[model samples]
Target chain A: MKAFKESILCAGHGGQGIVSMGKLLAYAGMQAGYQVTFFPSYGAEVRGGTAHSMVRIQYPEAIANPVITHPTVAIIMNKPSLDKFLGRIAPGGVLLYDAAAAEKIPEKTGVTIKKIPCTAIALKLKDKRVANMAALGSLSKIKGLFSLQELIQCLPFIFSGKQDLIEKNTEALRQGFNEV
Target chain B: MTPAKKILITGNEACGEGAVTAGCGFYAGYPITPQNELTAYMSKRMDECGRVFIQSESELAAINMVLGASLTGERAMTTSSSPGISLMQEGISYLAGCQLPAVIVNVMRGGPGLGNIAASQADYFQATKGGGHGDYNMVILAPAGVQEMFECTYEAFDIAERYRNPVMILSDGIIGQMMEPIEVRYPQKSVDPDKSPWALRGCKGRESRSIRSLFLKEGALEEWNRDLQRKFRTMEAKEVRYETYKTGGARLIFVAYGTSARICRAVVDKLRQEGVKAGLFRPVSLWPFPYKKLKGLDKGTTVFFDVEMSAGQMLYDVRLAVADDSRVLFHGRMGGGVPEEADIINIAKKAVKRK
Candidate 1:
């Protein structure tokens, strides 16, 4: 096998915290001292429209052009975003979308697709906003690229001492673990 | 230096932190999508750090403010995305002409216009090809994750000082929102603005030096360009950085950078499992592209797939390095759509079967 860098893409609506998920992954890479880059999209209409974020994580010496032309893994929170972006999935990429909100999966392709009820799982934890975090938890377990410990360490900064929010978000993530 | 511990912070926060760590005392910017967090974060922390955080009247004013601060030998920074960045180009070029060192961060999004707030790499040409005017290049650093945001932010400042030139941290929306653990280093080595030979201060002790890119003398302007070229050549040789993924024993190679490379890594793993050989080539530094490093690779006549978010700018460099025809292919998702791993695997398998 060849030595290669790992990249991740998180796409959804403006308020979906799609960019936050990418930030956590990039944070993990940066902590390891690997070269990491994060970029999120912005436009006037994104507030009510679909939005996405891309993160590139690689060795210090092995990165070029901080743009992701193709993604290996995608975590989609909304159906519109899924419909819009599903066609770009690489042959062996992992596609994880929210089944609870999506009416149906985008047919079938060569990619490894997983439809999880992220919002439902977050609902069980008493907050649907953490749905993005739930999806992140599932990604770590299935891909085995990131670990629970890393995600846990990241939670504090994300919630920023909001104990109640942290506790609930953590629960939502754990629920996602079981569901995935 | 050993690797630092990872922390979860948005790309905007990382940029602001990078400035703080880099001894930046002034920050000027306007509110723009995907990048509002940078200035917002600065507003919250700059005062505590005794830094000047200014929300200028416009993007133009913001960049000029940074220019003003940088002239006084203070480490200065500003950030914006696509449209806003476009507005600041004039100031950036002027700063370059004056040989001012300042760091600018661009959290790019889809565009020619308002485009979309979705993460996109459409600005590759703008950053590398000189967005403003004339023959000038900004030291562009593309960060695929949070740590790079922090590290590159600091490095941009360092490079700016070293070359007495404007440096750009060319990033996109995804990087701006990412949160990762980072080992922050407040590097030592401060510049004394008063000591600079050409800074505008009041000329209390010596002959006043006027900073301008324009010289009424015809030959003088040409000489300035020559000097810039010499400096750029030095940068190209000393600053190129890239990563090679599974180039050994592979008949197909996928070249991607930033976030796209992450997916490519997964694609490589899946292809290996399927008994197909595929690899990746990534360039970390944009300006001083790692051309020689790529040219030296032995692909055994493998096919090269240049993937990007734009139509293809980096592909031009790949072509230049390979210096061959019919061996290189292009794959990309324009606007704001990002390709998934399965798409990559399918492409790799097809390439393998074709060979």
Candidate 2:
């Protein structure tokens, strides 16, 4: 059996919900019986310049490195995120990004880039706030780490009390997954 | 035992759940960055549990409230950040002088002055060397991640109750603000205020006990000091907790606690893959210092690197543990800066070359 270990990064400004993306990944990883770790950049202004969250998931063996200075997957929600993190992705790694938030996609080798208009899809779903859900959906197809169904199953855990966001967020996730 | 559920939460929120599970009956705390979530969680939960939760006007008031609650033999606690904790040192000294059992949490941030709201472990001296003006040592549990934040908060109350002294759950902004999965395994064990013989509970049917720190009578204060010293020695022998990784046959060892330890673990694993033997010694109980296990590093070991987020605070303890036989090297960053793994890896590689 192969050991499962992959580090993912979600980067954007404060309001972009990159931290939520990191958390959703962790919740989904836990449900899949994988050990997980999540950390956000401290001391950064709550709504200030580029903010990022690092998450790592591994099987049984606890996430060894509590902090991921280098990630296997990079999810860029905005241009500032790309500028700061575009160089850190592992070789042959995966990049799931939002074309709506950033358009000047830098050309890089060895890695695969999937550009999904996450914000545009969320706005079309009538809730721009669910852009993070859309981004998570697109990340599902990048490496097929978690089944889209499993990712969908973790939604109720994330937006538990909201009740109302369950429907649109799922729709947004589906749209993002299919677009990739 | 496998936990029934896993919930993603920051260390601060996990500490809140831990305190609630530990039967924290009275919580009086002022809000501070990186630790505000703990106060907020207690504020809502304590009311539902029919306990007293006061958002005191200042940390000074909050700590004194904890002192009051503990005098009645109730399990009480207060959480604060670095600066806020500094303000509560005097009250903490009083708790020690009175021999009151209380729980104090310092979700430490950058220090010295009103430093930036980032992570640092510079307060090790203040925490272990008696932050207040007195000869006292609080049982300090340094949690590396969110899960320990929850479990140790519960255990901290138990230790304080057992030792009849203050227990501190020390964490940094990184640990406090970071989100991770945790399971709250223990439920709160409520303590009745009327149980302790030293408790001031209406003074009915028995001799009245006065909870006072001032002993002006001759030899009275000296006796209390001796008693405290013996208690401290007893705790040191019984309560040193630490974790070791790949230490059985290693060429290098890393002495770190909390977040820095986690980073060092990564570097150790990486170096091991490249055939350089490395290990990590993490002290969970910062007060007892875990010098015994650390002193066992055999002659096979080449060097020890003391890493921290502060300018050589815990490094001093690391040196004392190893006692200067091996070269105890130090590398750290401070004032809200985190120690990157690259710098640590570089430091270790340099030591390997010199060796």
Candidate 3:
């Protein structure tokens, strides 16, 4: 396959596992033989404030400039994130957002928008914290960049020793994937 | 040769792993933002490896502990951010003066005093120049990527031992917090304190020795200073390291280091696509400065554009190396602001289009 690059941005309020979602994506990309970089916003705002992470994956080549000014894919998990990063998506890029949290999303020219009901799906799984994973599931389904199995395999490493949480998160990911 | 297994890790963790792989037996550090991951990694990793890890009460104590460990001939290290590194300057001077082999990792944050936890190259002057009070120079290595973070730190120990001087791995918050895939590798031989002649290993079988920087005797201090200067001159001649990207027959070169260098590389790629002959000159060893190589790159027509996260700290060195102020231009962002690729591209375009 020809070398391809994807710059992804995951943004949400703190405690929503936005950084974890970005790590999962980058780890999956690395597993698929792609050079990847995951950069998280490190500041006092890490607690109950706006948080975001940037992940760039390039196949068969190293990634330069890990910071994404214009993202190829923006995963906005809440209203604040949608409001902040909506206009920064590249033309012809994909925006997968939480439909229940980010209400009345604005339309952007030349951008593909997929409104995934991420929070509602996580609520159905009996845990609303997995909303980031649900949104990530929709992202994978939309982009087809990494398979569901690849993402699932990363759970054991990311959420080590949390067997029950892993099971629920896996189900949440599957629900989000099937919903898309 | 066995192929190393690639693992996903943050820059901070990678530096810790590098130190561990280089047979670092002693690590002492205080918790600081951006660089806290390294201390945390060492806490667990050192325990697993049956080594020593200390969460010192302060940066002052931490650096002194490293000095103690180095005196005992253990491969030792300490890490911190900008302000914390400032606190350890006195200890650094002591290490340099005593001719000790030790590694210091500075994951620089924006700073004049207790600056916010944001990525900045503002500490370039502090790292390359003598941050502490002395006529001492520490070998400074600035790694631009996650893999180099590991590799540079791993090599820093050898460089320190080779020169019997303090060596610094000067990194920033961006590289510290960012995560990338890296293949970890170990050195062939671990550090053996008994092999060092100056090591204070009980001194039972050998004559008693002493290691101190305080020279109260007349002319003794001057003689020691001369020896230190000679070592520094030898380091300047032998230890300069840098990387050149696409500079072959290029009309413009971006001189940058660390995180800014990576962004400049992206700018070079974009400019090349636009038919502009742009390249990058990244100084891996900030102390040695690569003066001769930088001067050699000037063909009278090539304009050297220097970029940094600071307000042109390294620009002075570039100007001094090039010897002509007209041939050097600078673009920088201070107080934790990072220069974007678009801005650099615009600046480069204007520079290339100028008469």
Candidate 4:
């Protein structure tokens, strides 16, 4: 098979589940048959700091470092994450931001900008905590990195013990997908 | 692509899974950054595995606990990062001096006293060069990916038992923290201290075998050193492990190991597409050094580029192994920084320009 390489960076705060978003994407990406690597910041890199995760997916290949220098896609969950990563998106790449939470993002050219109000969508879904899921839905919609069916099927198992929230999260993802 | 039995897990979790797959029965460790997931994984799984897990009060206690268990002939292990590995140095030296079999993993973080939680391979001098004291060698296995972490950790117990010396899985925070999909296949062999003739488990109706490092008599320590050197020599002959890619016709050889090796691989692929004949030589075993692999190069055409995460720790070894000072070029970063593919490609271009 021909080589297909993609890297994504997700940045947000400590309790925002930004890391979980990377995990879910990686899991789904692997199921879609991509060699995936996810690197999460911890300790001094994130303790009382702006945390981020770099997820690299390669078709029929293994990637080194898992440290993405220029991400093909940047998923911003907050203002600081946007400020820190806005310039790092590759030319003609995509930047998805939670418009409900972030301030004005600096002007940029070439990169596609998708301003999804993930928090607003999640709020309408009755849980602002699922903003990450909204963003995840928008990401899959934009990138087509994984199938929606696979992502939906994996949710209950990913949140295996939490039977109560699976349906709500599935709804959040669907609403977020429709928002796109 | 038909996927293998893919299970995505952090590097540290893979290490824990490997330990269990290898049938390790004793785990004692203090939680530290990057490697904490390993301790937590073992903590949860050891009970189910019918093994022992002790979150020791300190790294010293943890390694000593490993030593205590190693004496009974159980496959024992301890996990730690740089600073904690430093704390376990005396125990490491003791493990070596007493010649007890055990596994130690240095999921290395930035160091020189609690530097940061970022990953670094600066401990190359420490892990492969003998951190504690005396003339000792740990069969150091460097795992570049999560799969290697699982397989190397699984194989470590067997190596430790076979050599009657400590085996180390020298990993860094990057690979330790990175999550990847892997296929894990565990071996069926289980380590039992009771099977070893040197085991200290109750000299029941038999002559006791004492294990200690103290030998104050004239030339006794010398004889012990001789014995250790003999084992080192044997390891040099039998334990060397490495992998090479596209080197048969390449003019530039990127010599590296661990995470740096993977980055070099990506660079090599890119350069190969760009019409630059670049190759990669990755050492899987650091202690054995794989010095012979650097030989038989087309001397007139090849230039070796030594890449590392630390500020050129492995460069010295590369130069020594290549035995040609003029051909080795060094580029690296430290304090938990990693070199990207672009950076290495630029370095390679600059190196080519100089000569």
The whole-model lDDT of each prediction reads 0.78, 0.86, 0.91, 0.86
Instruction: Pick out the ten consecutive residues of candidate 3 chain A with the lowest summed lDDT.
Output: A42-51
True-vs-predicted CA distance for residue B2, candidate 4, Å: 4.6
Instruction: Report the lDDT tens digits of candidate 4 across residue range B83-154.
Output: 999999999999999999899999988868888888899999988888889999989999999999999999
Using TM-score, rank the candidates from best to worst: 3, 4, 2, 1
The superposed Cα distance between candidate 4 and the true structure at residue B340, in angstroms, equals 2.2
Count of residue pairs whose backbone atoms collide, per candidate: 61, 1, 0, 1
Model 3, position A5: C-alpha lDDT score: 87
| Global local distance difference test of model 4 | 0.86
Q: Which stretches of candidate 3 lie over 4 Å from their true place?
A: B1-4
Off by over 4 Å in 4: A1-3, A43-48, B298-301
Top lDDT model: 3
Interface RMSD to the true structure, each candidate = 6.3, 3.2, 3.7, 1.8
Ranking by DockQ: 4, 3, 2, 1
Best-to-worst order by lDDT is 3, 4, 2, 1
Residue-by-residue lDDT tens digits, candidate 3, A1-180: 678889999998898899999999988887777889999994475768889999999876678798899999999887878888988899999999888766677789999999999999999988989998898788778899988888998987789759998998899899989998
Tens digits of per-residue lDDT for model 3, B1-355: 2224789999999999999999999999999898888999999999999999999999999999999999999999999999999999999999999999999999999878988888999998888889999899989999998899999999999999999999999999999999998987666348789988789988887899999999999999999999999999999999999999999988999999999998999999999999999999999999998999998899988899999999889999999988888878899998889999999999889988993
Which residue pairs clash in candidate 3? Answer: none
lDDT of 2 by residue, A87-142 (tens): 88889888888888677677789888888899999889878778988888888877
Q: TM-score for every candidate vs. truth?
A: 0.75, 0.96, 0.98, 0.96
